[model samples]
Target: MADRVASDHESITTVRATLARRGSTSRPAIELPDEQSSSSPDSASSRRDADAFPAGEVVRLVVDGSERHAKIEEYAGDRSIPGAYDAPSMARDPDSASNRLVEWADDKGLELGQSVLVDVIEEGFKYGVREPGERVFYDATEAPDDSLASIAQQLEDN
Candidate 1:
């Protein structure tokens, strides 16, 4: 019984050490710019670019020195319209603050697809000391113009 107990303790210690090492060696998450697209023929470059940006990733936003988190939501339509591409919608965690922000924008006559600036805070940093790690600019408008398909076809022909 004593030997069995000692063995289990040793096993637990080894496992804990291994997990700690793995955690310490882990790399930070890489975020890619929205402007970069990966349609390149080289698989390695494409993979690297694709790994740079995560879909629906959560980011911190600082508005008037107040900190809030938002998610990067892709609209995926005509890129010319503001919100038709990558946009960050204010995240609603425990309340409807995001909805209120949207309403405020609407009330202000900010058209959907118009650009709005959002300050994204850095992870694990004091908000006061760190300037926004990333500035997220998204279109305020939501409607997609169907006319872009004809333009795309024209470009493909050229």
Candidate 2:
């Protein structure tokens, strides 16, 4: 445990030093672990186990022939809910705000009385309304300029 803590401390110091030297013309290169290495911090397993959602991140889910979006208040193991969304504005009904998953399903003509396949479009949010499965994709280029993905990218670039 002591060794692990020391390693963590060293990693933090390295990250801080890198950040502090960001603008220097001769800033030292920070070597990243190989992508093929499972032990890499950037490994898929580590990221999934880590906090998937930071503030302002929303999960987009595609279920059946429709999509939905939700804000996951917390992560519960490897579970996730997937769907679609509108940037900035969410299609919400005042009476069903607390049950947006059902609302979205109903609005999209998805029948809750039957089994459905739910695939995650992105990480960090969930609103369970179907059986969770592997990651999926949609044409995000159609997303608005003020989308969560765009905002996250901008934040990272800064």
The candidate maximizing lDDT is: 2
Each candidate's number of clashing pairs is 4, 6
On residues 1-158, what C-alpha lDDT tens digit does candidate 1 reach at each position?
13222111211110000001112433111122344434322111222222222345443333333344444334452111011111133242323233323333445444433333221122221111111222222212122244773564356456
| TM-score for each of the candidates | 0.29, 0.30
- Against the true structure, candidate 2 reaches a TM-score of 0.30
Please give, for residues 53-127, the per-residue lDDT of candidate 2 as tens digits. 333355554333344554432233322232234431342212223434444456545442333332222234431
Off by over 4 Å in 2: 1-48, 75-88, 91-100, 103-120, 124-158
lDDT scores in order: 0.26, 0.31
Displacement of residue 113 (Cα, Å) in model 2 is 16
Cα lDDT, model 2, residue 78:
22
As a whole number from 0 to 100, the lDDT of residue 15 in candidate 2 is: 10
Model 1 RMSD, rounded to 1 decimal: 21.2
Candidate 1 local lDDT, residue 137: 24
